[model samples]
Target: MIRLLRLLFWILIGRPLVLIVLGLNVRNLKNLPLQGPAIVVANHNSHLDTFVLMTLFPLSRLHRLRPVAAADYFLKNRVLAWFTLNIVNMIPLDRTKVGKRGEDPLENCGKALAAGEILLVYPEGTRGATDSLAKFKGGVARLKEQFPEMPVVPVYMQGLSRALPKGEIALVPVVVDVFIGEPVAWAGNRQAFTQALQDSVTALAAAAPHPTWK
Candidate 1:
């Protein structure tokens, strides 16, 4: 089955390769809530961020975690689409209509969370500066508002962008650190919640081990 291959690839190859080869380190993993519906929000830097988080999760419950990805980008080709859906267990959002009511991007994600699936969403919408956080979008806020009961845990990582910065095929060995923070409390309005979420991620980034390169 594809699920078995995914598990094998990550457990046998992906996790070890990243953790050992790239020197990826994760912290505050104990902060992740067990036996509950929650979304993990992180800053998007490079592709490795997803793998680092994916490998760090409890393998037994990895099936319950879904990463919110860009439909337009990842699904652009047949092979990539198949890999993302089958192997990566990603839920795609049509970024073209992200905030549009006619095409609510999180429609599928909301349904997934309703079934108690864990989510990994990048609030910045897309990758940004490696050294600083970018402006976050309101999709995360809207989703939280719809599913107010589900907690959104803030996450931050460092050194991935330098390792595999956008467009470079060559991957440099870089020291990476992932910091998971406490769940964010909604601030009533969407705008307030958005700001609070970004702030939470920034706070967590303070703990990243500074990379010598980039």
Candidate 2:
């Protein structure tokens, strides 16, 4: 039922609806691992980023893709929470206070990756102030540290924030580009690996700022 609903949303609404606004350009499509359990890490600036990423992938993989989202934001509303859990395949992480289980939030992420699912994460922890990236948090590093064999793909999203900023509700039409960079190998040190991961994203952004609109 969840897969059917997601297929319907993507076919009837999600993909077609976004074409009216989003102009997605993915560079180095081959960079996306042909298989998973892999992790795609991107800079977070807007909620729209997740949709943009999913729309770019084939429907078959949609069911296999899981996004790590804020438990506080997506889970508060029962209706939205239901859709997020069932349709969106979100792994809700508690960014505020730890849950009663006291388990590491990233442990859930690792579990997903271990389960052969494609996981998407925002290492910045939250939306940034602008197009510029915020210093990456170490959670992503910890995940990679645990699953060193799983490839970490770096993706950079530019212009989505303008389409849907941190505080806005209404969607605005804007040309957005999704940059996919070659998988970056994790260095042993967490700090160094995070920095390298960040630089990979930066390179993708600099290489292709946006698609040429004609």
Candidate 3:
């Protein structure tokens, strides 16, 4: 029942909002993973980033596409918690209790990957300035360390910040460009792997066509 509801929501609402109302110029769709135990990493800007990335895959595979989200923000309210957990199918990572005794922040993520689920991660940890790339956290690298063979795909999105800026509620119509780069491999060390992933995303961003907003 939950799966049906999720499919309906994305097919009826989420996809239309992202692919039509907002508009998406997706490049290199072939780079996306058709199966999982995979990680799709992108720069964080706005909340719409998750929805946009989810739309890249076929609705049938929506069940396997899990976005790694913060527990505090998404699960703060009961209504939102239920919706995100069930409808959006998010894997919540507790950012506040990272280093506490016996707390595994990436535990849920690990389980998801072990189950061959595709994880949509924002390596920036949190959203930053509009169209600006921030320093990536080491969480993704840690995940890669655990699953050395898993493919880490780098993606860059443009114009999402302008479409729905940080503090604004109403979404302005903006054409978003999505650039998917080749899969990044583990570089033997977490720091080097994280840096390589960041570099791949930066290069994709640099290749995106600049859009003029009136």
Candidate 4:
């Protein structure tokens, strides 16, 4: 109910509101897989990355896809907390703690897969300032290991950083490009898996002609 309303609000009101004013050009809608338990991994840059990713699919799939987001940031505010958890159906990830030393949200992802749900995860533990991807964490590798059968799709989002930078609320009009690469095969080895994941995202990012920063 809440999810439906939010989706409608974003589509009819929110996205167009941005598009009318900012002139958002989101392309490559045909690339995303329509069904099954697949891990959609991407390079994280700004808060707008999720919104841009959401625009890649139709409103129907937007209801189906659940973006794996950080627990702290999303849950910080009351309105966003309710929307991300209940509306967006986001899988809450503990970004602060990781590996054996901290509480892992990867296990929850496994459970979601068992339930036959699509997941979106940012292999980069945190958001990056530059276009180049950072070293990917082992969680993605571990998830692949746990579910070797599932495909890991890599997507690259360009111009989102420019749309709404790290510390800014107002979104600037920018032509955002979303490149969806072919599904990456999972190798059994953790190191190898992580490397492959990183490589795919890097390749996708390279596909776009983003302005380089100092």
The CA-based lDDT of model 3 is what? Answer: 0.90
All models, RMSD in angstroms: 2.3, 3.4, 2.3, 2.6
Every model's TM-score = 0.93, 0.90, 0.96, 0.87
Shift of residue 90 alpha carbon in model 1, Å: 0.7
Report residue 120 deviation for candidate 2 (angstroms): 0.8
Which residue ranges in model 4 land beyond 4 Å of their true spot? 17-29, 100-103, 211-214
Better of 3 and 4 by TM-score: 3
Error of 1 at 89 (Å): 0.6
Candidate 3 lDDT over 1-214, as tens digits, reads 9999999999999999998899999999999997989999998888999999999999878999999999999999999999999999999989877888988899999999999999999998888886468889899999999988899999998998989988889999899999999999878799999999998988887787872211
Task: Point out where model 2 deviates above 4 Å.
Answer: 96-102, 210-214
TM-score (C-alpha) between model 4 and the true structure: 0.87
How well is each residue in 17-94 modelled by candidate 1, as lDDT tens digits?
688878866788898865446888888888877887787678887788799989999999999999888888999988
Q: Tens digit of lDDT per residue, candidate 2, span 54-100?
A: 77788888888899989998999999999899888899998754454
- Specify the highest-TM-score model's number: 3
Angstrom error at residue 130, model 3: 1.6
Error of 4 at 83 (Å): 2.2
Model 3 alpha-carbon drift over 4 Å, by segment: 211-214
Residue 4 lDDT, candidate 3, scale 0-100: 94
Residue pairs in clash, model 1: none
Each model's lDDT: 0.83, 0.81, 0.90, 0.75
- Candidates sorted by lDDT, best first: 3, 1, 2, 4
